[model samples]
Target: MGNIALINRRNFLKGSAIIGSVVVAGGFWRAAENGVFSTGKGPAYTAWETSPNGLDGLVNAALLAANAHNAQPWLFKLGNSSIELKADTGRNLGPVDPYLREMYISLGCALENLIIAAKENGYSPIITYFPDQQDINYIAKIDLTTMKPLHMELYDAIPKRHMNRGPYDTTRDITQEIIVSLMNLNIDNSEVKLFMFDSQQDKLKIGQAMIEATQTLISDKEQIGVDPKWTRQSWQDIEKYKDGITTDAQGLPTLTRMIAKILPPLSPEQNNQFWLNTLKNKHVATAAAFGFVTVRDPQDYLQVVKAGQLWQRLHLWATTKGLGMQIMNQLSERRDREVSLNLTPVFGEKLREILGTSEWHSIIQFRMGYPTIEALPSPRRPVKDVLVSI
Candidate 1:
């Protein structure tokens, strides 16, 4: 194992630094600049601003979906009866996500949430992908004119869906029944497989492997810069960026933060020791880690986005069932995709052999269980910062 990249947790506890600042949003602000202000223009427009049943509600819900670095990268154009979903190019994590794959997946997650909310409110959304040539960033355009009321059980869990980073309760088991319900989302004939390691012994073993893998990946300078870009320095920084992950809200506990400063991404021996300590003392790997695998199509941005959408849906569904989840993508890195998904207990060597050069890159991974802790909500920038009026 290479040196373990320790997070500077003390920095968050010590308060603000020169470069980072915390700015939590307790009130509304101006709309995003270049805001989509439709006029008596090409497409007829009906403002959903006032109606309790229109665009306003959908926008609010869409805004809630998880994002990269909290960089909520999207803009909406309220048309006659539809909303346009455009990628906020300014928010791109160029260094890490240069291809913008993660951004699209994040957008897809948000889009799925919007659809769920819209349906519950009695409106049908018609989606058109890649609507315009000039705007390569524009992912989709949803025509809402034909929307109708539909019963969606997912609504009840919407409010509970949260990003959990705490230790999971390994004593409890996530049965095959729950796993089957999650697989139902893949009902479109997409080959989706669920691989889970639930026992405490299994979790510790997997966690050890994951920790080793993450340490190795982070030691690479190129990947380090990429990962840090997604990591917000402080909670205050988190609030201001309206995107990056925050320590106080999304990750480590106070005690862990103190150790972070001391470790500061140590040597290989230190990394091993850190992992040993984490396994011995901390509850970082609380639950059995879970992963999703797609068999038919392995490398399309659209498929990645679809997987993310299903991920968020399952995440919310788990939340509604009183469970929490934490994403673990270290093993899923493009470089180590083989080790992560290939070593599933059930498929064994056959799975590895079958993956064929299609490269089974992990789209998402999480640890789920009931959470008793209340995490501070990460802040979001005013919508105006990202919205571009077309």
Candidate 2:
């Protein structure tokens, strides 16, 4: 019981605060009173906490999942030997994530933690999505069955998984073996292609394309207005605001926020020039990038969640390999605006010619590399605030 209490308290401290703080050997930590309910303990549910780490461990770990702007928008309904993930729509980034794309990723992160912890506790989680959409918050139902947890190599990757936005070591070329490993993990029905631009010239072209996309989107009125609110300015601001993608999002520099906010939105000429410069400079930059593609005929709820699962595991795998990644999901972001961009030439002539329609090519993009500096932990809302009791 005392062991359970200690784990619970540690989780509360880590969840409500930041996971990065847990690094220090001896530090001020949050505590759980009454041995059951405490400040960071999630909502009261009827479930019996039977995991080796207890419900608190599972819930707190879920809370640690990184989300857009660090917006910890979720709630858990503890059930008999199970946990339910529901969206806290009130905290939704409605305009930018109108379709809750980022929300899906956030939920994926939580589900990833749950799956890992369940396995650690000798159980496999059964996941069902939107079993009830009448409740917008209800995301999924997880049933934990009694089964001996086999040691999964992927589980070892969980705690280390992080979004790496910085430049990677282009000199250290990625082997075909690693690429195959990544390819094999695509459990979803979606088709995934891994493109490696190992050459300096190819890297340059892709870099320029990415910069162009980022610059163009940044200036896009809809994007600027919608994305800025979610971008946290500094570590102090993260502690102050207490949620959303802080500067620590992807562990990128916080100053990027300041620069982003001050930059002028691109005009037509500027947008084109931005792409041109991106292409020119990308050729010289030192890093590796990858494109994650999905083939969802009509993007629906199930497809998105499955993409999340594949993405979550891939992300963890990258971390285990000592690689860092940051989602370059701009292509996915413009799924609805394909016609406006006339992306045929941009994506590739083959995609344009083969599909006969401007199908979304990349669902996600990521730059990989080891970081020069470590990221400070972003904040999450208190468990009491996130979880709702019946």
Candidate 3:
């Protein structure tokens, strides 16, 4: 009887070990399949490497442009010697961008890239904004003419520009010379103005405003709900959609990201809190300088688009300088939300105060500095997916 009992116990223990091993193996398999390890390698990123020429190449470069939420909310209509950039309103963040402000801005980012690529690929591009008054979505039409290939430093930085969400190296300060160079990118643009806040006092003021705005945003249930829809938590979704924010790009440590892949996804509330924490700890804390782009009227879509173009150009220039940049647009977003709801423009007022002027309206805000870690690229929809008929 004792010998039979001992054999049964051994068999049970062996079976349990097998199940544990299978479970552990299964978790790892899922992680690998879901892209817990892969950061920027996929069909989505092929455009960066292919480097095709002419209109097709222009579209490829446009796909790499920086946009809000990684929404990539713009479509291209290619012509023999032209390209039409259209806003994909359907992809707009619902409450987060009620005015379609960010949507138009995103289209502007794509437009900037298209123009840069066109210039680099031996074409002089002429842009006509709002080519069709009836269809606001028809954002811009670029007519291209053959020209000598103009190799620009900004054009070369196209594929290299990724938003760095990680903590910056606070020890390294951006020099005045670099700041002046960045400012020069927008020197000819009269509509959109760039402002920088590098002093400790100024950074603290803007950082506090950002935190307050983030809190306001997360508390709004509708905004919080809509925001998460664009966040791709699984590797399957990341590859499948090829657009939207991913955990790997969130600046979390590698170990934390791996563990997050194995663990259940965070609830919306938890995710909101996590964002708030990250903003306070990783982002705002380490920002060496904060800057914002402003226009005379925030409601002017054209001005907003120009602001985005300025941002893209500035970012590309910054990339060449080996600086990391992240868009800190929560305050601007909250301001949009306020306008949409007809609420008092609390955030708007704060922004104006920070800029120390009521004349210019803040369209976009960002921070830049030397980064402690490399920023990962977010998934992008290939040019093929974004091309539209007619």
Candidate 4:
């Protein structure tokens, strides 16, 4: 009896030990699968938390500006008292942005942030656009002079501003006062105009146009092929590249993001379909309002850049007002593609009809509202990576 009891006790102890080991292994697996070890940590995100003084700090702030596909496509040439902004054309979004319209707008965003940071750092920035007209890539030159530090509310919102791609709170409506304030953001700029669409009818019109444009864009073989190149699937890639869109920034529910991480990487078709579905179900359906930044000429790079600066300032202001915003530039993307291919301007016509204005060309469109979930910051290349020694 004693020997039997001893054998049973040993078996029970062995089973308990095995169960404990399994539990431990499962915990680690879950942690790794969810990217708990990486997500927003690392050199890519350090700029948001730190405030280095001078040119480096300005560059860091510029790095946080909203960009197409999270592609940080601007490089800096720091001078004794000037900072030159240049477009890194190599990072251009292939067929996705054939004309580099979005690219210049992205540089404009960076330029806006740099100017805001300069003011906050006690400098008056004198900006010269296309300092070297001979070099198209030479975007802007900002000559800074000492001044009493002028801190603006928009400057304080720089680090807090993020592109919210998740579903917004439909229950909360943005007020007319807030919308008017947003409209006033571009009142001083005659080249760029801001249009707001808040009525349910207008929202439906814009949402349908955006959905159709997205469908058309994803159907293009070249676009689909090139677009996925900007998506970072693994944590390793996210950290190593520190530039493209990641799962965490997709605005997926926490559990959904975790599940996606555990699964094998999605195929290009799957990714495209997922984007469309999310746009239809989460983004468009839940948006509280739609807005457009229209310019006198879409082909004019300077106007596009100014449009971008307005967008950056608008987004920062929105952030200060505790609002969430995401660019839904699919319609513009489709229009560009049509122009490139000399196809019928189906999307362009739609945009004009929605805006009720042929006088202004739409350069960018975005949705704004209160987000259901907090938006995470996309990874940014550090100042060191972007600085060019001139």
Best by lDDT: 4
Error of 3 at 34 (Å): 1.8
Error of 2 at 255 (Å): 12
Once fitted onto the true fold, the runs of candidate 3 whose alpha carbons sit more than 4 angstroms away are 1-26
Predictions in order: lDDT: 0.55, 0.53, 0.80, 0.82
Model 1 is weakest, by summed lDDT over 10 consecutive residues, at 36-45
| Runs with alpha carbons beyond 4 Å of true place in candidate 1 | 1-53, 133-136, 146-148, 191-206, 227-231, 234-239, 251-284, 293-295, 334-361
lDDT of 4 by residue, 158-277 (tens): 989988888999999989999989988884468899999999999998999998998888788887666566777777777778888787787766545554565566666666777777
Q: In model 2, state the lDDT of residue 325.
A: 62
Report the CA-based lDDT of candidate 2 relative to the real structure.
Answer: 0.53
The full ranking of all candidates by TM-score, starting with the best, is: 4, 3, 1, 2
Worst 10 residues of 2 by lDDT: 1-10
TM-score of 3: 0.92
Worst 10 residues of 4 by lDDT: 1-10
Clashing pairs in 3: 34-235
Cα error, residue 70 of model 4, in Å, equals: 0.9
Using lDDT as the measure, name the better of candidate 1 and candidate 4. 4
Give Cα distance to truth, residue 135, candidate 4, Å: 1.2
Question: What's the candidate order when arranged by decreasing lDDT?
Answer: 4, 3, 1, 2
